[model samples]
Target: MKSPETFEHLVRAEFTPKSTFLNTATNALLPARTVTALQDAVRLRAEGRPLDPLYDDVEASRAAYARLAGVPVERVALGATVTLYTALIAASLRPGAEVLTVENDFASVVNPFHVRGDLKVRAVPLERLAESVGPDTDLVAVSAVQSADGRIADLPALREAAREHGARTYVDLSQAIGWLPVDADGFDYSVAIVYKWLLGPHGGAFLAVPEDFGDLVPVQAAWAAAEKPWDSAYGPVAELAHSARRFDTSPALFTYAGLRASLELVEEIGVDAVHAHDVALADRFRAGLAPLGHEPVPSPGSAIVSVPGLGRLQPELSRAGFALSDRAGHLRASFHLYNTPADVDRLLEALPG
Candidate 1:
């Protein structure tokens, strides 16, 4: 782990936020290196130079994310959105199979299963998620961290319950990956969008699956999913990749180019360090909220502090240079690696009495 002074230095050198940005749950601000990488990718296209380098960016990001998620590179699939990966998982289920999910989970994690129309989808509160898994449950899908209020799902309990019930687990890490320690190997399938806590641009997402790729159908498989993409470009793919690469979509090249740098930065700072830093700031904000007559949602050990009945203040907060979110009438503020004590104090000071 990096020392606090070193972590602070690295964070300051990488990010130059223009606001008291507390909304990493909504989207992350790109680091300076990522911005440079994006600019370079655009310039490379403008010059019509050989596009070969961008492909390396894609693979590097995949490997980096695989490492972060504690999965083998061969088990990770690259894609543009979490929904696409969720749809692939959904398609693999037999008709009438039940998927148990948390109520009001991010749509990408739950809607794909529901859209299948044939699957029996059940919604339960986050607290009851693990205990609700039973013999009838074929799969358990939920976000590792709740997006609306940052209530963390008990993944270990969920995994144990799923295993005991002869069920599979699918975890959405979109809001948890960068700052939270997740063991992707414990779940049957897990997906994350890089633009949020990963601090990358839009257009990059990842799906991690078990060694057998969770028997996903790869319904959208194209030449990109082939064992030899260039050789298989024209015809039906001679052979799909034997690994999870077979689930990959044609990547957004420029996005991955920037994401590579951003992910590398996260690797350098370490997720544990980021988790400690972010949660501390969030705790600071939470502690001060009550003194101001505001109560935050009860989310212990989370880096997101959400206050119910304060959604109307979002516009006022934004105008005052506090960047956060209004989610279903809750004022949601998420702290991240780039956030500081001063940032949290400023938001608290600006809040109404």
Candidate 2:
């Protein structure tokens, strides 16, 4: 086991705003190394290359992310996962199609479907998710880790059920990636933001679509997604890139650079190792909060530890130089690679009844 001081020093070095604890609602702090790398990419851009191609860092990033997810680089789509899904949901569902999801999910996943007046949306009771899976369901979107309650649904099981009903399954891995293990084979589409659990930049994400699902297309295709990014300023273009790059076009170079750095750092550390370390800190934080008469809501397998009354104690924790967040009436404690057991202890010691 790493020493407490070593852990603190490591975390402090990466997250420069050392005093602030990013135990927030759903978001976690990006790794410090990622920020520095993003700075380097900015410098490189300012230095200027005579001519550079779009997604210059793409191949390297895809290879790295693919290795992590145990999928092929060609199978991955890099963009804001939420945007990718939003576009996909709008494109995939026709009028009057019903979308099924759990009530205890992140608003991002459910809101998009509900907005379509023609598409009816229904909530599957958490206790009866299996029963809810049936024919006539147009799509089933679910969070790998519940954004509100932090519960992890059985994605594999859900996928299996959705398959039986001929419904396309979409999974939000935003809170699960980097904190838990995910099998790419289980879902037809997997969406995630690299910023949160992946400890990367916010501007980029991944949309993993299985090869067979060629019918799935984005509503808006950008320049980068075109077969010839150099040709035509505007038109309804179908000559999209051969891979998931079809949906994600154009380049957010800086964000991509930051994401590359973050992914590289995680790769060096190993995803499984990251999960173990975070779970340990979360466990410590949960145990520490137990005596305060606060109970942590169970999450699937991520580093999020939410206490029902944490927000109520925010003032007290703040007075002690610590901060916490209250989302939907629960206090959420999130851990990242930079966090250590001692930090959990400090937050624990600082909590008030």
Candidate 3:
């Protein structure tokens, strides 16, 4: 797992001559295999054939997601991004119910429901979130990993606490899914943007709606969600899909091809390996930064490491061919499977003391 030399060949990292990219929090580098898939998708689209769910790669993409999430195939649905899926989940909650989230969660996770007007939002600090949930809580919506500080949420504990309050859990896996081992079992609904950690095509995402959520209303409607999406009848009422797919958002027909390739590449590498590689990178980073006396965030073990004063160095470092995201008053250095210890070492050497 510590093969820093061979690991460097896995990504398009050298596309930039003198640059080191530590910014998966903003955008990820596409794997070589994924680029090939994109080319194939564009070529196939040029043949002037209409897209069909059966003929296209949608089903295959769905299957890949199901396998990764350990959920039944029918329980998965594709969305253009996590925003649309979160909106659907927010729309389905009982009217006027409370959605307990955190103030530091990324906007996409909180804004979708907060804008609803009908639901009351009680956003608190992450440390107190589990203690704050009570019987009045109807939904506990949060990111599996806090976007601001890179703190991994205690999923099993939170879900168990939410259960006591009869609250359904909706986890935004955008920051966790591909790089970490996430269990979709405890959460009633989980959503993720594949491009971030999955190294997939942009605008590709998935949502999981387990039957444990009971009856839910699809927030939006598309003919593609009908039981017979291909039926030319186009009747007044659509016989919606029995699975969570009834809530499916319209997909980018060509994008799924690349997405499937990306998913396969990640699976081939195995998430356990990805997580191991990611944590190792973080460990090295902490050790390197520790003696320098930079401030580390709450969880140094996570893939995303936040440090105070790192944000101020972004401009100077960018000129030196390194990249990271400045978010929530700190610079977030995120790692991916494609990243190697050499990448971390480069940043360690490059950063200003």
Candidate 4:
């Protein structure tokens, strides 16, 4: 049987730029199966037949994603999370409604709040999010994990606070979903990218909106998102899918195929097992940091470890043939299924003691 690193090597070797290092930010790359699936999906599209089955695949992909995310299939919306969030924020808000957010939220999330008209913005401390969800705040939007610090927010508290104020909560689970366990049941709505942790292709994301908000329209719509099936007789109308399909931006065949493969891989290795492995890798990294006298920031101590190392680690790590990320006052290390104990050890050896 192939060892874990051997399996990773086989997958990585298939890609170019022979250095073959894994990116710590996204944790893993497209495996051979995903690449093949993408090629097949593209070839099928070239034939020019109606891809109603592709639509079914899209629905199935979200169902698989919802199961992995611990949410009901009815709650899942499939699309680019950023695009979906823009539509959701637009639909959910009245003119001049307040959106309470934190300082360190991801750019994709914060941008929608900033650009939207008829919306007032309120910034709050990352820790005091619950307290900031005041009566006037119509929506409490946050990244489940702060992109800057990699801090995991206390989601339940945020959900409770939003409910107390008659406000809705939108969670950006891009950085947290696969690495850690997220209870989508807690938030009124949530958005996440599939590429980062689900090991899926780019251009695919998942959104879980509450059942009651079924009437809420997505500002961005495609023919696939129409109320009726795609038939020649009916003209294009943005009636939207009654289910989470309302967020679809047409059928993305290649990406959906890649996403389906990744989802299958995730299922093969249970999410619970994946989370355990990731958390253990993170714990190992944190423990090693102490020996080098490098301290990790308090909040994102596990799964993703961020630290104020001696200098910008991106170039240094890159020069050393290691894949890692640096941003917002700290160097971030994300652990995924592909990472091994040896990789962690090598990372430690590369850092300044």
Better of 1 and 2 by TM-score: 1
Report the number of backbone clashes for model 1.
0
- Per-residue lDDT of 303 in model 1: 92
C-alpha displacement of 237 in model 1, angstroms? 0.6
lDDT string for model 3 (1-353, tens) is 53545444544442332467788777777766667777776766687655553236788888888887878888888879788877877778777898999877899998989888899889988877888899899988889887777898888889889888888888989888888888886778888887788777788888888874454677575676777777713654358777777777677866787788778877766788778888889889888987777867877568999887678777887888887877766878988776668988988887767
Best first by lDDT, ranked: 1, 3, 4, 2
On residues 1-353, what C-alpha lDDT tens digit does candidate 2 reach at each position?
34555545655666654554746335557677777777777777787853243256656676677776667777787765585565676567788988888886787788878777778788986556656988988788788887665677777678778878888787888878776878866677777877777777667777788875545756667777776777745876758777777777555777777777677767766677767788887878777776887788876355787778566766666676665667677877777776766778888767775
TM-score of each: 0.99, 0.88, 0.92, 0.88
lDDT for each residue of candidate 1 in 301-320, tens digit (9 for 90 to 100): 99998999998999998998
Position 189, candidate 2: lDDT: 78
Between candidates 2 and 3, the lDDT winner? 3
- How well does candidate 2 score on lDDT at residue 80? 58
In model 4, the clashing pairs are 96-118
Error of 4 at 19 (Å): 5.6
Model 4 score (lDDT): 0.74
**Models, CA RMSD each:** 0.8, 3.0, 2.5, 3.5
Q: Single out the weakest 10-residue window by summed lDDT for candidate 2.
A: 49-58
Candidate 1 TM-score to native: 0.99
Candidate 4, 154-210: lDDT as tens digits: 888888888888888888888887667778887778888888877888888888887
| Structure candidate 1, residue pairs in collision | none
